[model samples]
Each structure stands twice: as structure tokens, then as C-alpha cells.
Target chain A: MELLKCETSDIENTEKYILKNGEKEIGYGYIKGVEINPIEIFIYENERSNGYGKLLFSKLLEIIKEKEAKLLTFDLPEEQYRMINIVAYSGGRYISIKNGVRRYILPIK
Target chain B: MNNTILKFLERHDFDLSLIKKKCDLGVKSSKDVNPIIAKYYIGKGEEQQRIYVADIVGYDYSYMNLDNSNIIDNMSYFYNENGDGYSTRSLSLLDIPTDEIVYRLMGSFTRDPMYLMEADKGKYVIDSNGLHRLHILKAHYLKELSELEEGDAIGHKILEDKYMVETMARKVDYLKTYSSFLFQQIARYYGCDFDIRPQYDDYGELTGKVTIELRGKNEKLVLNDKQFIKLLKDEIANFLNDNSISKKDKKHFIDFVGQTIEEYDSFKEYIKQNLQEIYNECFSDEVEVG
Candidate 1:
């Protein structure tokens, strides 16, 4: 699948998963609060394993820190153990469970 | 020609009356008589009056009279090169020849405070006298006046002014050095590599660009210009949620970001107007309709 980089506003129909090419969007990440380079990464099931999750998580971390983030945190679904593993491997620590979702943190220097 | 007789007359404090009487007897000049003429008497009595008469005659006979004295000597008694009056008592301190006494007196008189103040409001006091003292003090003690000449005084003034200019220039140089250090610290904090270039304008302003190079593939989020702008707007909105920033300050901050990215002013205004909406859409949970 061709990786299409578009603005958040350009992404149409949030609910409908539009499948095109061999690349399925594993997850979506968005910049969050302003404690410097903040980002929230969401992993989708289709792009799980195969190192895409790890690659995506690392990319998000690098981008956020370069954007001048002092801290980066994200929410991972409690059931997504693989995604949780990937987050943990990327220097993320379990912060707290909020509303049954596990929150993780990666402090950017 | 009887030196013994003249000496006997001087020892007894002979008046001009005695000198005139001795002169007819053919005893003319006396080194002894010269000393008596130079002697100062305090009270305005007959003895002092006699001394004055002898001085006038001695001056005339030796051609040291007011009109006939060397111009420098004539002027030296009334004024110095600095144009201050000379007291005979003051001249006794000099070790120079009798004729050169005028030169030494003028030098001392020129440095006198009364003359200096009347001449130029202490400009000479600071530039000439003060600098001389400062130089001597730097040398650990006062130097002899013989060692200091007119050329040295001018050089001292020039050196002082040069020192002042150098001190000021050094301070500016130090400030510029400190500013670059602070800039480096800030750039490192942002996780961006920056090369701080010298600022040319006044007020020591610095200008440079920050390069955010992604370290690994898929390891970071790279955004286009539009996405980056939108992300900035979201970040600003989040910051303002509980911040005490005024509306004007918020607008100014938006304008500042726009300027940083070289965007139009109108774009900043438009982004600021829609910041809240963008935040709500991006961050708020949506209700899924199947």
C-alpha cells in the first residue's frame, strides 16, 4: 500500500476502513498536549506484528522528541498485548490505567 | 676693592646711606650687599624701607630692574607659564640655576590648582595632572618630575582614552559570547541541532534556523507544512485551556509562530480563529454510527 501522508482534516470517514494497496494503516497517531513534542499513537489490528507496530511506535517517538517534546505518552488498549510490548520496548513505562485503557509514557530528553 | 670693609658693612646691616657713602670712597660692588638686598623684612618699618631702597638700587645697578630684567624673569615673578603668581619663598624649593629658576617656577605654577581651575574647569587637572599621578601610582610610587616630560603627558592622556574604549569593546564581546552559549543550551533542549550564527543588527539579536532531522525510518512522525501548522494550532489550544494568557497575547503568539514559519499574517489570524474547533475535532471522542 502506498503511504499517503495527509493532514488530519483531509482524512475522510473516520469509521470506514478504506483498504487500498498492500499497506493497511496499522494505527493512527496525533499530536496531543503541549508539554513539548507530545504525541498519541493508536495501533490498528491489521498492521500488528511483522515489526510494523514497533517501527511505527519508534517513528512516532522520534518525531515527537524532535518537535521539542520533553515527555510523550499514549494510550494502548488493554487487550492489545503486542502493541503494549512494542510500546514497552520503545522505552515506554506503564503510567496508569484510565477508563480500562492502559497509559504508557516515554520521557524525551 | 676692599672686600673686608664691604663685608664689615654687610655684617652690620648697613643701609643704602652707608652704601652711597662707601661708593664715594670707591668701594662699589659687594656679593655681601646682594644678599642684604634679597633679604625679606616683615614689618613696614625704617629697616624694611631701607632694604627696599637698597633692593631698587641693587636691581638698577645689576641691570635687574623691572624693565631691564630678562622678560621671563620679569614675568616669572608675576605669573608662571600656567600664569600663576610666584612667591620668592616658593622658588627656594628649586635646585636649578638662578636663571633657569623662571622655567621651573612656571612649570610648578602651571600645575597649581588655582591656575588650573581658572583656566579650564579642571580639564587639565584630570587629563594632565590626574593621569600623571595614575601612571606613577601604577609604577608603585611617585616618579621624579625629571623623568616626566611634556610628550609623556600627552601620551598618558591618549593611553587612558584608549584603555576606556578597549574596556567597553571587551564588555560587548563578552555579552555576545554569553548569548551564543545560552542559544546552544536552548537548541539542545529542543532536541534539534542548531548552529547559532552571529547577529549583525544592533541590540545583539541572533538569527538561525533549527534543523529537525529524523533519526530513523518510521521511528518519527514527519509532517508536511499544512499538518505542521495544524499540529501547532492544536498544541496552542491545549496550552490555553487553563493558561492565564490574554487574548491579545494568544494572538501575538500565533503571529509569532506564523512569522517563524514564514506564513502570511492572515494565515495566522485564520488559524487562531479556528484553533478551538480544530482542537475539539482532533481530541474529542466521537460517537460511532453503524
Candidate 2:
């Protein structure tokens, strides 16, 4: 239930979590520095298309705002259409697409 | 020209039976059959030449020559050729093997309008055989063959060599580690405890097989075939959903899943269908009770 920042020491733990929970690990976003933040919001295999992604993403937005980060970004290379729809519904801005990876950014007020 | 090669093949002490067997195993064309026969018939003298062509196409004995010399016209022929061909002449003036030359020829055939048409219509083995050649060529020849992008040529050469070793050689110990890794991943996903160690057979044949020993008490869930299928399907679905994989990868994954399901289902069905015969064959030592 704890929302903690992922550190260099947590690499193995994060990998294990990713493997265990599958796409649900997307909710655990990465914070790079004072200015940049990257968030991942996963749609679990069984729970896909059930509005859980949006709820988790909303929580991620709240976290980004709390962190006072300048730029917020996330990449959804797979399931682009579904991700795009979710991001658009959540009022996130579209960023550039490069190397088959789609990036979306939400500015913290 | 093909006839000439065929005649040469016949004249040599080539194992026609083996060649015929290879052809039957989807080798198909005369070009593929010839080199395999030639390798057995005339080893070392033509070894380098065979290696050169195999390095280009990414498979052994699955290609044939279209017999056109004009580079433009022959692009289709080269694209269509599925197996390896041997030529004493180095492909380039620098005396290097002609793997790159054939690779590019195969690549251009797929991209060019005329060649693509032929490939789409199945006029050639362009999809399975030519498509792979085209990929290797494009990867290596995005620029001129000389200005190859990183690992392009080397990658193609490796694929070619791997195929040759897989199909032609009596033993392929080199690929054991790679195959082991793949098998381990598959076994782990299936929730089966297995160990695969490499060892040679009595004839000194280098072979590798997984020794899957079921660990722990036989759980009821594992014993249920229907549950196993459901678990497999769920795991596959999760894997596909988790990875941001490409379209081509998805196709391959789906095909793999289908094949696995079919194999397991068929095996189970065979056991059920032949239960009485199998019981008689194995339990004949037991005292018969009328």
C-alpha cells in the first residue's frame, strides 16, 4: 500500500514485481531527477478494458504533481491505440513519436 | 545451366537417396538438393563455395538458381532461389565470398515491383525462402554492400552458417547453448521443473535433450489436462500483453502457441485412442484373468 520512489537498489525488486504482477507494474512510475518524471500505468491481463488503467493513471498524475516535477512523460509502445485513448481521456498532451515508441506528457500545474 | 549442374551431381558419388530425402523434407529445388549431395560427394574442394552461398541465403539447400545473368532480370531468379549454390569465383573483385552479392540480389528481388509481384503470387518460394534472404540483404545492404550498416553482413553470415550446421552437419554442438536457453524459457513458462544438459550419443553424435523430471507431489491441477491447457493459454495471453512486441512477433507467438496446443492435444488423444492396445503391449507380463 506504500507509494515509494524506486531507487538504484530496487532494480531487482522492480524486475521481480514486473514479472509477478505483469502489466500492473505500469502504475509504478520512475522519477529521474528534480525536473523529469516518467510514469508507467499497467493494465493487468485479467483487468484490461475495465477502467482500471484510467484510475491508476489518475493516481500517477497526483504523484507527479506532488513531486513538483517540471515534465511528466510515459511511453506506451505496445497497445498504442488503447493507451492513446486513456491518455486523451485523462487530459494528457501528446508528445512526439520516435523509433516506434509513443510518448505522452502531462504538465504539472 | 541447371541441367549441367544436375548432370555433374549425377556423375559424382552423391548419395541420391539422401538428396531425395532432403528434397522430400521441403528442400524442393534442384539447387538445394545439389549442394547437399555435392557436400557429401565432394567435401572441402567445394566447402568454401557452399559456405559462401549458405552465408548469403540463411538456409542450406533450400535455394535454386533462376539462371538469368542480367543482374536486373536475375534479381527475381536470385530472390526465388531458396538453397545455397557454389561458385569458385569470389563474389566481389576483392576475393571475399559472394554471400553479400547473393544477399543483395535476393533483397532487391523482394523490394523491386516486378519481383514483389512474383513473390506475392507464390511464383517462387519468396515468402519463406526469399523473404528471409531479402531481410538479410536489406539489413546488410541498406547502403551499398561495401557501406554495410553495423552487424548487417555478420548477422546474415551467422544465420547462413547456423542453417548449414543445423541441416548439413552430423552434429551441431555449437547451437546447444542457444537452444538450451530457449527450451529453458519455454519449460519455465509451462511451470515444469526440467534440466537440459548437453551430451553425445553412443555413436559420438552431439545431441541435447531436456530431462524433465516432475518435482514434488503430483498436484491435481498439474494432472488435469484441461487445467494445463487453460494455464498455457493464460500464460501466453499474459506474455503477449506484457511485452510491447511488434506485429511480426505477435504472429510468431500465436503460431507457437497454436503448435504447442496442437502437439499436446494430439499426444493426449493418441494415448486415449490406443489405450487398450498400449495396455496389452506393455502389460502382457501380468497374469491374465479371464
Question: Best-fitting candidate, measured by DockQ?
Answer: 2
> For each candidate, what TM-score against the reference?
0.22, 0.22
Residues A46-73 of candidate 2: C-alpha lDDT, one tens digit per residue: 5454455666666666765686665455
Backbone clashes in model 2, listed as residue pairs: A26-A40, A26-A41, B32-B61, B62-B82, B62-B83, B63-B82, B63-B83, B64-B82
Over B1-290, each residue of candidate 1 has an lDDT whose tens digit, in order, gives 13432332244343434323322211112112221111110011000000110111111112212343221123233222232222222323323332232334344333431111001111111111111112111111111221334568874553343222100000012122222222233333345443322222122122221112333423334343344445444544454452444555444443444352243232233334544453233333751111
For each candidate, the DockQ is 0.00, 0.02
After superposition, candidate 1 runs with Cα above 4 Å error: A1-4, A8-28, A33-44, A75-77, A98-101, B1-290
Each model's C-alpha lDDT? 0.32, 0.34
Candidate 2 residue spans exceeding 4 A from truth = A1-37, B1-290
Question: Judged by lDDT against the true structure, how good is candidate 2?
Answer: 0.34
Screening candidate 1 with a backbone cut-off below 3 angstroms (N, C-alpha, C), the clashing residue pairs are A1-A22, A1-A23, A26-A44, A36-A69, A37-A69, A58-B219, A59-B218, A59-B219, A59-B220
